[model samples]
Each structure stands twice: as structure tokens, then as C-alpha cells.
Target: MFALITDIALTHIAGRGRQTLVSILGVALGVGFSIAMAALMQGSQEEFVTSLIDALPHVDITDEYRDPPRQPADLAFDVAAYSNLRPREDTRGILNATEAMTALRAFIKGNAVASLKVQAVARAGGAETGISLTGTDPVREALISSFDEDMRKGKLSDLRASPFGIVIGDKLAAKLTVDIGDTIVVSSTGDITRRFKVTGLFHTGVVAQDNAFGLVNLKAAQIIAGRPNAVNEIRVRLNDAQSARDVATQIERLIGYKSVSWQEANESLLEAFFIRNIIMFTVVGAILLVAGFGIFNIVSIITHEKSRDIAILKSLGFAERDVRLIFLSEGLAMGLAGSLLGWALGFGLTKVLASVKFEIAQATEVTHLPVTFDLLHYAIAASFAIIAAATAGYLPARKASKLNPVDIIRGAT
Candidate 1:
């Protein structure tokens, strides 16, 4: 019985091959566009998050800005607890330099590696430039971030090595009009002025950050601030950036300080990722929805044209369900073929687009686009198109099937 129904539907489709081909192509294009958009959404999210993270410290610890961040009193251990763990290539955080060193030494106990960082602010030249100074210990700082490559000229100062050396961003250095080894009058935000040699120039491609952000030695900053052992911020580096949240929570627990992970610190940017995905899905869905109407229109036209045949079938003992099944089979067949072809086209299109790249600027290069074909996503899309198409054909198929044979065959005479 199923074979007979399929044969009848195929015969009808074969008779109207041109219209059927157009419907299939429409469905295929719609399905392909949707699948490709979904694949690209995830990749784009990752890229955006990475770029945003680069704009600030890797992870931050300070006085808890909100309700006291909870920590178990018993959770007491130094950086030594994870001596065997190594920091990955990309990691940088501002630590309370002096205190962090003391804490790290106590925690490690000569077991393995440890590091330090510091955060300070300087009112540069006058009150106009609010220079946010990042004091770093050269030996440990490289484990997390590299200001070397990001620099336009000169290099980041070694705090333990350079007495009063500083590295300003290229943009910031331009503002000061001071070159390497030139003394720049710097004042801490606390209202104190001091002279420091401009040892180097750096640029991180972010205009706002490089323009206002500066780098220096922990010792220099501490001395200038008139404090021997104090810092407002601490950066902690863990084994993996993805584990940064866990490490951030652990740091807060262990040190009794308020801390925030990269994700939490940049919540708005992270949330943007989800928002982008939703927008992409909604837009692509609208395209598919429009294509669905094409299915409905085509099926309805076929039904109207086949009314006489449907009446003859009813007279010959065909049931309403059977009539519905026949039309549904046609719809499903169109969806199935289109879906398979769409997947192929989508995959091919993604690969082609990935290779064709463009750059936004000299600093921002357009790398290959990212895409990954997911079976679940493809299946879901295919199923939706099929269901919508089948339902569309149902009402018209039923109306044709219920016609009285005499009226339909007699041509309304």
C-alpha cells in the first residue's frame, strides 16, 4: 500500500517536474542558509570573547565590590599548592606586587615556580592624563602577558632590574612627546610628582587602553606612592584560561579578597555572544519561514489542479487518510531531497567563504572564518522544514479528497 502511494505521488511529481524542481531549489537555499548561519554563530562568539579579554587584565582580585565574596576560613594555602601546574602562553593579571610575592614565597616553599604583579595609577604630566599604571615583575610577568610584541618601540621595564624605568604605549608616548631614556614628569593619582626615564614604547592595538594605560616596576610604583607594601589589585594565573573562573573563586576563598574572572569582569561582552546567536537564528528562521509559504502555495495549486482526479479516487474507494498520506509523501520527499542537497551546499559554501578573507585594518587582520557542521542542528532544521511542508499540504489535500465525484467530473454544468 505504501509503495502504491509513493508511486502515485512520484507519477504526479514527474508530470510537473519543472514546478517540483523550483520548489526543491527554494527549500534547499533556505535550509542551506540556516545551517551555515548556526555553524558560524558559535565560532564568531569565541572570537569576540577572545578579543574582549585582550582588552583588560586576564583576571582581577580586589576588595570585593559587591557583598563580601565568601571564602572558607579553613581554605589557606599559598601559590605553592599548584607548583607543578604551569601557566599557559596567554596569561596576565595584576597582583598586589609586594604582598603577592610574600604570599607566593610562603605558599611555594621552594617547591616550583611562582609570579607577581601590581596595579597603580598615575596622574600623568598634569590632571589631564589619568594614567593607569600596571607594575609588573619582569621574571614572572612573561608567564601571563607579553608587552614586547605589542610594543611599537623599546621594551617593558624589569621592576627588579630597572630602578625608575617605565614603558608607555606608542599613542601615550606621542601624547607626552618624550622618547626612550627621556625623563617624563609623572604624578601618582594621590598628588605626588616624580621623574621616570621612558625606557620603552608599546601598543596593544586598542586605542583607549594604550592611550591611557602605562607599565612600570612594582618597586618604583610602591616607592612613588610612599608605601612599602600595598597594592590595590592582584592578577592570578592558572593552568587554563577556561579554568579562570574556578581559579578566581579559589583565589577569593584562599586570600579573603574580592576577585572577578575575565567573564564576570566583562559580563556585557560575554552576554553579547548569546545575543548574537539568538539574532542569527531568528533571522535565518525567518528566511526558512518564507520558503515554507512557497511549499504551501505550490501544494495548494497542485490540489486545485487534481480535484477531478481526487474525486475519481474517492469514487474508487480511496479514504481521506490515504489521500492525505499521498500528498504528505510528496511534501516529505521534497523536504528530504532539499535537505540533503542543502547540507552539501552549506558545507561547500562555508569552506569557500572561509578561504575568501579581508582585513578591517592594518592592526586587525581578517583570518579564516570559522564554521562547523553539526548533525543535530542539521537534523532539527530538516525536521522542521519537513513538518511545515507536510502540514501545509494537508488542508488542501483533504479538501480535494472530499469532493463529490459527480460535481467534480461534470465540470459544474
Candidate 2:
């Protein structure tokens, strides 16, 4: 009975011809706006989360000896007092970084702490481009974290393959104008220099990590930098990301050192994302409200025009509930139809946006915007649109149902 009434209401609107065109259009526009907003959020948020996840290792344990801190106080004051401290700034220097890296590698492999400092630099394109090498053990790096398959051009170089062999980022490759197997000169802050062949390029789609920090064999890096077995920091990866802080605290106590999480490592970017998300919600909410107005006005007009029909139905011994259902059906039908149409339209539009990349070439050359359409997003947006339409009809439907049968009958006669 409910389904039949909804069908009748939809047919009635079609029969109204040009008069109801505006109503249909309004409903369609509202649904479209809701869908578009949802699509944008889904695409943008996924892009951000995925990029960050790819760029940063899920969990890491760095050496407490020389914490890579932006401020002096950021480093743990509980660090062991080294009687033989180096001059100014950092105490670990090249030798210490290598040793820390070596110990970290061995420790991760279920052995004693193979602490060592690994350092290496890779020539990306020319003097204009720089690709800094991350000194870490190949075995430990492989166990730490991984990126999407599409991002990697090939496997990382052999751990003991070459003294200056380096892994690169796809974004970094594009920036420096280089490719795998290409030879570039690497220079270290310690005045050490070496020529390294690009072994592979990993794309992760993370602009920061890919464009700045590539990877190199810790041992090879140590050799190239002329600092055998000295590492600036020790990095540890665990099974869970959330457990990092607790594990870090435990590690700090056990090793008598400082430890950090991925969140701390990338706080600036995370904060920026939080702000962006809030802005998105604010803007999208306003847009959806504007769309809701379309439903409201259409449902209101439909009730006004069908006054006599509602009255006749009540006079024919039909319950006010039935009359209410008829009007409610009209709004729901409109919502269902429009939401489906809008979903299809929005899906296509997202692809168009992806292909028609932004032309902001001034800062960087990221041509296309990435978009991913997930079914979950579609379900959420469509459900909301339907509920909004149902609610839009409730008041107007109630008013129509409450009308006295005599008034409508008299007006019709």
C-alpha cells in the first residue's frame, strides 16, 4: 500500500507537467550538492591519510644518544652523561650515528644491539637538486614499514652491494630529473663525497618524504661517510602504531634513552590536516543546508497544490494516516530518484576532476588531483539525502492531512 501510494504520487508529479518541473529540479539540485560534498571529503581525506601513512613508518624507536629534536629541551634530559662530549650542537656526530644504527639493526633481528650510524648522500639531478640518504639497515628497514606497490619502481639496493648505491623517491626523481641506474654525486655535511647510482625509486605519493629523504644501506652509508659503525639515532618499529608512546616509554626506561612516535615526527602536517578537515566540514555543511532548502520548498508547494485531493481521500473514509502517507510518499519518491541520479552524476564528476588536474604549477608540478571513490561514502551520502527529504515532507504532509473534509469538498464543488 505504501509503495503504491509513492508510485501514485510520483506519477501525479509527472502528470503535473511543466508545473512540477521546478520542484523536480529543486530536489535534484539538493541531492547533487549533498553528493558532491561527500565525494570531496572522501577523496581529500583518503589522500591525506594514505600519503601520511606511506611517508612515515607506523612505529619507530630512535637512539636516545642524539635525539633529532628541533629544540634543545625536546631531547630527553635523562640521557646518559657522556664525559667525552663533542664541541657545540650535536655530540654523536658521524661516528656515533653509525654505531647506533648498527646496534639497532642487530637488536631488531633478535640479536644483541647492532648499534651503528649509517650516513650517505645521493646526487639526484644536478647542483640544483638534493636527495639526502637515510642511513638504516636494509634488514631493519624491510621489517619497519612498506608503501603501496604502485609507488616502488624496484626493490631496494643490496645491503652490501655498493658503498654509495642509493634508493630514491619517484617524486624526488621527477624533481631532480633523474632515474634508476643514473649516477649522481652525493656530499655529506662532514665534507665526505661519493658517487652513487640510483638503485630504485619509491613513489608513496608523499611529497615531503619522497622529495627529501631517500634511503641507503646503513653499512654502505657509514663507509661512504667515512664513519664506520656510527649512527645518530636508533629506530624501532612495532606491531601497533597506537602502542608507540607506551612502548617508547618502556624502551626509554629499559635502555635509559629517549623515544618518539610518528605523530611527534610529523606534528606540523597532522595539525594542518586537522584544520583542513574542520574547514571542509564547515563549508560542506553550509552547502548541504542550501540543498535542503530545495527539498523544503518543493514539498511545501506539492502539499498546497494537492489540498483538494487530500480532502477527497479523507472524505472517502480513508484515515488521516493514509492521507499523510500519500503526501509523505511524494517527498520520499523525489528523494530516492534524485539521490540515485545525483550519485551517478557525482561519481562521473569525480573522475572528471581527477583527469582535469589543477594548473597550480607555480609552487610544484603536481598536475592531477587524486580521487578515490569508496562505496561506503556513497551509502552515507545517499542515506542522508533520503532522510532529509522524508523530514522535509513531514510538516507539510501533516498540515494537508489535518484539513476538514467539508472545506476541501465545498471548494471542489
Candidate 3:
């Protein structure tokens, strides 16, 4: 019985071959676009996240808060609390860094933690550049950062071998007109001055980092910054990046300093991605809904043209439910066909996008557009298409089922 109903449905659809083809193609276009868009957006997001994770620490333990919490108001008389705010500048370096690092290592076992000092370096030729002079244990820093992988020239371990040796970015090397075996003058505002030999150069694919960042031995950096055995920042890389926020909170509670996760630092960027996803889904969904309307129009026309046939089937002992199922079957078949074709088309489009080559300024690694072949995108697109098509067919099928055989047959006679 089910086979007979499906055959009848197919025959009806075949009778209007051109209209059925058009409807299928419409749905296919919608689904294809949705799949392709999702692939590109998701791929781009993944790439962005990978770069961000590689470049930044999962959590940073800074010396002090940028803006400390305001003092509580006076309880007596419900009066506002007022205190003299002075312009005295205190040292910004972290105190007791060695003890802090030791405590942190014991607490967060199996995690990578390194100290860093950021300061300005000026050349004797009057060229001053602000650089993040990272102070690190060569072996331990490698565990936390991708510096070893991104090393263009020179060994990171060399910084340890030579106390006065420094590893600078390629862009900074160019600006300072210095190279390996060349000496550059470095000075800080605290009357700390030194001449260091450039032993190596690196490129991290980030323009800012490449332009103004350098690395040196932790002891050397402390001496250069005029803060003996002091570090301004503590960077930690956890086993799981997703657990950074929780770990950061734990660190703050254990120690009396500010701890920040990468996610917290880039909250605005994450919000932007979220909003973009919402907009993309809404636009694609509207396209699929429009395609569904095409199916509705075609099905409605078929029901009207076959009204007499429906009445004949009813008079010949066919149940109303059977008649409705036949029409619904037609819709389901069309939707299934369209979804399959759309998946193939979308896959082809994603491949084509991945093959296209392009260059972006400051993003040296992006040689081609990113297009991920994720099955989830295809599943979502197909599911939406099928649901939309089935819904469109339901209304016309219901109307046909409700028609009275007595009235339809009487009118025909």
C-alpha cells in the first residue's frame, strides 16, 4: 500500500516535470549557499583562534590591576568617602617574583609558567622602539610559546649561552639596521643602559610582535630593566586552553595579584564572532524559507488540478489518510532529492573556495581562503531544507484530505 501511494505521488510529480525541477533546483540553491557560507565562516574562525592561541598565553598573572577597585563608602552618616589622590608614581614591577613563581609551579603542576619584562629600547642613532623584552628560561618558554617553531634565524638557546645575547624580530632588526653579530644599545627610563649583541631573529606572523618584540635570558632582562630578580608579568599555559578562566580565578585566589585569561582579554573579539554567526544563520535561514515557499506554490497547484482524481480515489474506497499521505510523500521525495544534490553542490563550492589563492597584509600565513569540510554544516543545511519542504507540502496535503467525496463527485457528475 505504501509503495502504491509513493508511485502515485511520483507519477503526479512527473506529470509536471518542469515545475518539479524548478522547485528542486530552488531548494538546492538555498542549501548549497548555506553549506558554503558555514564552511567559510567556521574555517576563518578556527584559523583566527589557532593564531590567537599560539601567540598569547592562556593566562597572564600581572603585578597589579590597571584600575584598582574603589574604596568602600563610609558607613557613618551615609556620607561619601573622600581621600587625597596623589600623582606619585610607584614602581610597576612585580615584587617577590621568584617566590610567586615557585608557589605557582607547586600549585599548578604540569603547566608552563614564565616571567616577562616589557620595556622600551632605544638606539644610539635616536631611533627608539617600544619592545616587549620577554625574560624567560629557554627550555621552559619553549613549552609555553610557539617561538621555537616560528624561529626564522638563530637558536633560542643561544640567549642562555651568552648572557648579553638577545633574539629580536626580523622587522625590528630591519628598523634598527642591526643583524646577527651586531650590537644595539638598549636603555630604560630607570637609568638602566646596556649594549647587547643580536644573536638571532624571528618572525611570529604577527606584524606587531614581529615589529617590536625581543627575547633575552631572564637574568639578563632583569639586569637590563634595573629590577634585580623582578618580573612584571607571569605567563601560564594550561593543558587545556578552555579551562583558562577557571584556572586564572584559582590563581588569583591563591595569590594576591591580578590574573587574566586570554578569553577575558579578548572579550570584544569573541562577542563580534558571536554576533556574526547569528547574522549569517538568519540570512541563510531566510533563503531556505523562500525556497520552501516555491514548493508550497507547486503543491497547491497540483492539489487543485487533481481535485477530481482525489474524489475518484475516495469513491473507490481509498481512505482520506491515504490520499493525504500520497501528497505528503511527493513533498518528502522532492526534499530528499534536493538535499542530496545541494550537498554535492556545496561540497564542490567549498573545494573551489579552498583552492583560490589570496594574500592578506600582516597575515603572512594566509595563502588561500580557509574552507573547512565539516560534516556538521552539511547536516544542518540538509535538515533545514528537508524540514522546510515537508512543512510546505503539509498545508496543501491537509486541504486535499478534507475535501468531501460526495460533493466533489456530485459536482463532477
Candidate 4:
């Protein structure tokens, strides 16, 4: 019985060849465009997040506070009673940083946590330039950062090899007119001046990082900052990035310093990504909805044209449900065919997009438009197409099933 109904449905569709073809093509275009747009947006978002994660710490434990403490006088007395009391200046630098690092290591046993001495210094050349210096242990820092992977000229371990060795960003080296084996003088406001040999260079693919950041050994940085045995920051990487906020909260409680996760640090950018996805999905969904309307129009026309045939079948003892099923089957067939073709078309388009390449200054990481072949996108497109097609068919099918055989046959005569 089902096979007979399907045969009838196919016959009806085949009889109106042009209309059937147009309907199928409409659905295909909708699915294909949706898939292509999803691939592009999702791929670009993934690339951006990957670069951001690699370039920055998952969690940063800094000497500064998220909110500075109130002055002792303010805490002890009400504002109206002791308004003349002066506020004490907040002290800078983490006290007993080495001990704090040890406690943090024990607290987060499985995570990678490394102490770092970060400071700003004046680099003297043709002109004075301010740059950030990050003092790190080559071996331990590698576990928490991709710095070693970003090295372009020499090894990060070269900093360990020489006491005054430093690795600067490629852009920084260019601006200072210094390269490997060249010495650059660095001075801090505390009357500390040092000349360090550039032993290596790196490019992080981030303009800011590449243009103003340099790496040095922990002890050397301590000396340069005039803090002989102290580090002012720590970086952590967890097995699961999503757990960073929870772990950061725990660390802040234990260490009494500012602990911030990457998500917290880049909240604005993450919000932007969220808003972009919503807009993309809404626009693409509207395209699919328009295609569904095309299906509805074509199916409705078919039902009207076949009213006489439907009456004859009903008079011959065919059930009304069978008549409805036959029409629905036509819509389902169109959806199935369209979905398959659309998947193929979308895949080809994505491949073409992935091959396109162009260069932009200061955007070292993006050479081509990213297009991810996510199977989930294909599944979603196909599902949406089928559902839209089925709903469109339902209304016309119901109309065909409700027609009275006697009235339709008499009217035709």
C-alpha cells in the first residue's frame, strides 16, 4: 500500500517537471547557503579563539588587586567622623613570591603554574621606546605557554644559556634596528640600567605582542626590575579551560592576589562572538523559510490540479489517509533529494573558500578565509530543510484529503 502511494506521488511530481525542479532547487539553495555561511563563521570563530588562547594565559595571577583595599583609617572610622584621615598608598609587588609559587603548585597539583617577572623598561636606541619584558624559566614556561613554538630565529633555551640573553619579538627587533648578537640597552625608572644581548626572536602573530614584548630569564628580569628574588606574576594552564574560573577563584582565596581567567579577561570579545552567531543563524534561517514558501506554493497547485484524480481514487475505495500520504511523500522526496545535493554543493563551495588566500599587513595569522567542514552543520541544514518541506506539504495534503469524492467528480463532469 505504501509503495503504491509513493508511486502515485512520484508520477504526479514527474508530470509537472518544471515546477518540481524549481521547488527542489529552491530548497537546495537554502540548505547550501546556510551550510556555507555556518562553515565560514564557525571556522573563523574557532581560529580566532585558538590564536587568542595561544597568545595569552588561560589564567593570570598578578600582584595587583581587582579592587584595592580601603585605607586603615577609613576601615577603622566612619567617613563623616574621620574624613581628614589620609589614605595610605597601596604597596606594589607580591610579597614572598617564591613561597606563594610553592603554595600554588601544591594547591593545583595537576595544573601548570609558572612564576614570571613582568616589567616595563625604556629601550634606548635612536629614540627611547617603552617595551614590556617578561622574565620566564624556559623549561617551565613552555608547559604553560606556546612561546617556544613561536620562536623564529633561535631557541627559548638560549636565554638560559647566557646570563644576559633575551628573546625579542620580530617587530620589536626591526623597530630597534637590532638582531641576534646585537646588544640593546634597557633602563628602568629605578635607576637600573642593563645592556642585554638579543639571542633570539619570535613572532606571536599578534601585532601588539610582536611589537612591544620581549622575553628574558627570571633572575635577569629580577635584577633589571631591582627586585632581586621576586616575581610579580604567575600564569596557569588547566587540563580543562572551562574550569579556569573556578580554579582562579580558589587561587585568589589562597594567595590573596588578583586571579583572572581568560574568559573574564576577554569578556567583550566573547560577547561579540556570541552576538555574531545569533545574527548569522537568524539571517540564514530566514532564507530557508523563504524556500519553504516556494514548496508550499508548488504543492498547493498540485493538489488543486489533481482534484479530479483524487475524487476518482476515492470513489474506487482508496482511503482519504492514502491520498494525504501520497502528497506528503512528494514533499519528502523533494526535501531528501534537495538535502543531498545541497550538502555536495556546500562542501564544494567551502573547499573553494578555503583555498582563497590574501595577505594583510599586521595580520600574520590570517592568510585565507577559514572554512571548517563540521558535520554538525550539514546535519542541521538537512534537518531544517526536511522539516520545512514536510510542514509545507502538510497543509496541501490536508486539503486534498478533505475533498468529497461525489462533489469533486460531479463538478468535473
Worst 10 residues of 4 by lDDT: 109-118
Q: Which stretches of candidate 1 lie over 4 Å from their true place?
A: 1-4, 39-41, 68-128, 146-149, 152-160, 179-182, 237-250, 308-321, 359-383, 395-413
Candidate 1 at 64: error in angstroms?
3.5
Judge candidate 1 at residue 43 and give its lDDT: 61
The residue-level lDDT of candidate 4 at 42 comes to: 94
Alpha carbon deviation, residue 243, candidate 3 (Å) = 2.1
**Model 2 residue 328 CA deviation in Å:** 1.6
The local distance difference test score of each candidate is 0.66, 0.63, 0.84, 0.84
Which stretches in model 4 have alpha-carbon errors above 4 Å? 73-90, 107-119, 361-366
Candidate 2 per-residue lDDT over residues 1-413, each given as its tens digit: 77767676777667665645655555555555555655676567667666555445544445444344444533667454456645674445333444444544443422112324433345545544555566665555665546325336666535347556677777777777878878777777677877777777776545666777667776656765666655655555555565655655655555545656666777787788788767765664555455555656676787788787777777778788887787777777767776777777777777776687666744345566666666765676567667777777667888878989898789889
| Residue lDDT tens for model 3, 165-262 | 88889999889888888888888766688888898889997888889888888887888777676777888887788888888888888776799988
Instruction: Provide backbone clash counts, one per model.
Output: 7, 32, 0, 0
Q: In candidate 4, which residue pairs get closer than 3 Å at backbone N, Cα or C atoms, i.e. clash?
A: none
Model 2 regions more than 4 Å off: 1-4, 19-21, 33-37, 64-133, 139-159, 164-229, 236-259, 271-285, 354-368, 409-413
Every model's TM-score: 0.74, 0.66, 0.91, 0.91
Whole-structure CA lDDT of model 2 = 0.63
Residue pairs in collision within model 3:
none
